[model samples]
Target: MIANRAEPSMTETSSVWGTADVSSGKGASDENFPVGSLLISKALRPHVHAYYAYARVIDDIADCETLTPEEKLARLNAMEDVLLGKREAITRQDSMSAAVLRASLTRTGVPFETATDLIIAFRDDARGVEYKTWDDLLRYCKYSANPVGRFLIQLHRESLNAFPASDALCTSLQILNHLQDCQGDLIRLKRCYLPSDMLALAGASQEDILAGRTSPRLRRVFNTLLDGVDDLNRQASTLPSHIKDRRFRMECAAIVELAKRLTLRLRREDPLAGRVALKRTDAMHAALAALRGWS
Candidate 1:
């Protein structure tokens, strides 16, 4: 049994279905990641919504501009405590996402320990601990991306170890996201997840990045990173084979297409200032292609 603290009662029972609701995945079309859209079957949307809502909540708390680092960490810790069937949280203010997490805990028995790892990863953002190497980024992914993959595996009653292919696909997507958001991560959050070796390999310095300059060295660095992303993209293509469900296959396809497109962008576009992204039309095409492939 998880420890119980004097936390607030789980009183809010509101179904998260609002326009701005992250769980409902209404704005998935605009997201960098395509998981929400790919998982849009009516029967499964609710579960996906629940997970996305909870993720969005933890993410918001960790990323929100209004909260201080200590406050964010406290909230995240409280969230962790609540997740493990523990009764203690810092506050029970009935946040949209917290409520969703609570309900997920009650309904799915998703381990609080795994969920807590995600919260801790988000909290790491507040501490401004940037990745110095690919292994360092992998540690971050262990907490952030790997847990989500593990939870998804549990959702399907699969073993985390049994589904190495799926895990690879999931982790690949997560790393791709980090690469895509490098500029935003640095400018907006003052965080850099880029590996130091990659930087050195490119002969690009943090000073060059901060100044928004696109030297030949920076271009080479992106090429190297892009090459790594290509390997992950290939791994993602085979993810459909790991799971039996066709729905997940469709999801994998959509994500694979998106990854492919990103890889294309890296090859063709100059995304150095960190503002690189895929357009909606292109994403829709990719998603469509992926869905068709599964069909």
Candidate 2:
């Protein structure tokens, strides 16, 4: 474990916590879906960015090839301490985003768990937790993905009823991402999010995830996950109707449409062939979905 020490001054770069500067430089546009898009009101956008920045910081730490799992956890704990105001982010290595999120949470009354729960997921990723069952994968999404939707709903002052749909939507989005990146994740991070049981049931194994194309057996596993995504999107179809904020409602509507399109494409196309992504014309489809939901 890293020894605890006082936060460093701006001029000082070294600290008890090792700082390797692991920023991935990925941003909202690089994301599979929208984050703080134009549909989010101007007043709330900065708060969204704060949350994203903090999430990125933790994600970068977890994904950094150079850091050991213990080192990653230590950095995560240090960031969380600053986020909770247990310590100041005065350290040259500490992320300003943690402080920004702490202040934003205080100002907006959004629960800090919306940010901290992500830490839980990052910890799991850093530790390389195994997936045995569908329930296990869902449990992962409970922390890794659901919080983002919950944060947005809370920030918009939406009804508690929206949570179930938001969870459905967010979890679906997360699984979609896992499917899209299954091959790359296994190759790069030596990680696999596909449930072990599902792979087994389909006569596939974790090793098969390394294939350049989706074999028939592996495609069976992909189909099973997509079946779940289909149902989750159905549940989330009601999400747009729950939002009172016009722009946000449109945003949710657009995302829901995009999720549906991506699901269809996954069903029709092979993710292992390459990165399966939304085409530019999908924007027109989302715009139409947003209009329909707006009314």
Candidate 3:
């Protein structure tokens, strides 16, 4: 369970919460990593897809630039309502995503928090909340990233003993994503996931984030975050071994390896120059990782 999670502050469910589909058109293929990959059993794949679709819907609402904060919060509340059976979905996509996931969770007996907790983080994103310290960033991840891992764990009936390593892995991946998209986030959303104190400690300024390339001080900030990612990867490397399921273990191993690989790329390359990402060939390394973890 996510202990001591702060409730998001939003207006009471508006009487007339408007419905509009604001999907970014990002399918499973548009993600940074695989979703419902071959590692998961065919039978269990739909539940995973259902959960991903719900997440993507709420996520798109938070990131949609056109919606005001009130509109975003209202849409998010509507999603929660549909997800928890408080109301029926007004939009077709909402019915397909949130209402479906609600039914799926009822059948599977997974905790609703795995899906609802995401709204908290997305609410923060909608409000343009910024972080001050690494701990603050991790707290954001508690809502944003950690629940995804927890959902998988619960879906597979894994022990909570795996939570520590899983949280580390998820948080690292989230931070790496922040680093990779830092420039574009600033340009589009005016949001910076990079800890402001870390930037000040390294003598880097927000101005450096928008520049054509990473400045020296900004590079130092990136390296510091990467160093933290190194520690996280070390922690997350144990996640596969902690799992009881064979294929899921392989999936965790591959994801951990991808997180590690992306960390290395961020260290070696400049994200400000362009999007630093894994190539199709990187799948070979991920496959080998899965094989090594197979028992």
* TM-score of every candidate: 0.80, 0.91, 0.91
Runs in model 2 deviating more than 4 A are 1-20, 92-94
lDDT, candidates in the order shown = 0.63, 0.84, 0.83
lDDT of 3 at 10: 18
Report each candidate's C-alpha RMSD, comma-separated, in the order given: 4.4, 4.6, 6.9
Q: Report the lDDT tens digits of candidate 1 across residue range 1-295.
A: 3344332222332243232211212245546675545464564555556666666667766666667788877777766655555543333332444545666655666665556678768878767787887778777877777777666666665545435655565666677667666676676767787788889877787666666546687777767767776776676676666655666666666766776777787677655555568878777877686667566
C-alpha lDDT of candidate 1 relative to the true structure = 0.63
What's the true lDDT of residue 3 in model 3?
26
lDDT score, candidate 1, position 169: 59
State the weakest 10-residue window (summed lDDT) of model 3: 8-17
Candidates arranged by TM-score, highest first: 2, 3, 1
Please state the error at residue 191 of candidate 1 in Å.
0.6
Relative to the unseen true structure, what is the C-alpha lDDT of residue 18 in candidate 1, on a scale of 0 to 100?
A: 38
Model 2 RMSD in Å is: 4.6
The residue ranges of model 1 lying beyond 4 angstroms of the native Cα positions read 1-30, 38-40, 88-96, 158-162, 284-289, 292-295
